[model samples]
Target: MPAEEGSGIHCRLDELLADRGMTLTELSRRVGVSLVNLSVLKNDRAKAIRFSTLTAVCEVLGCEVGDLLTVARRP
Candidate 1:
């Protein structure tokens, strides 16, 4: 489903990964998630993510959930 009409869902995963000089493949390797699966999340194509997966990604990337995603009023 599309993001809610006014939820303003957005993602910063790619930007943060770039800032850390980490590539998708690298993140996949470290986080034990498939590159294809990570791509889904990175590209905002994923409908949902397991809490364990999210936690593992955060641990590997040294980031919080808030750093990877954001919700704001849709302009």
Candidate 2:
């Protein structure tokens, strides 16, 4: 599914992983999150994320929260 209409937050998981030559499966394993949950976040289908989950992902990706998510402008 596409991102929620009017929802401004954009997840940068796809770009970050791609830039680091990492796959979602590898990230999921490293971050201790299930592939399906990671996929939901990666696809921008997740409405919210737990802080622990966010921290884990950021740690594994070597990024800050701002690098993982952004405020997207609505067109």
Candidate 3:
């Protein structure tokens, strides 16, 4: 079924980082993003993400956009 409108959009950054044995600090440094910004994205508190930011993250993490983000269906 299609996810309902307003359903939560989640980030899998923590899981991806864990799988790669990488830390947020390391990723922040590699992606040239601030820890605060990465933390917001990792915690799914970010309302939007730039394509450049996404591309940088994907390059460092060896993942696609879909691997980093997901939508959680409303219960």
Local accuracy of candidate 2 as per-residue lDDT tens digits, 2-41 = 3354567789999999999999999989988999999989
**Against the unseen true structure, what C-alpha lDDT does each candidate score?**
0.80, 0.89, 0.89
Task: Name the candidate, 2 or 3, with the larger TM-score value.
Answer: 2
TM-score of candidate 1 relative to the true fold? 0.83
List TM-score per model, in order: 0.83, 0.91, 0.89
Model 3 quality (TM-score) = 0.89
Compare candidates 1 and 3 on lDDT and give the better one.
3
Task: Locate the minimum summed-lDDT window of 10 residues in model 2.
Answer: 1-10
For every candidate, C-alpha RMSD to the true structure in Å: 2.6, 1.6, 3.5
List model 1 lDDT by residue over 1-75, tens digit each: 126633355667799899999999998998899999988777666777899998999898888999987774443
Instruction: State the lDDT at 26 in candidate 3.
Output: 99
lDDT of candidate 2?
0.89
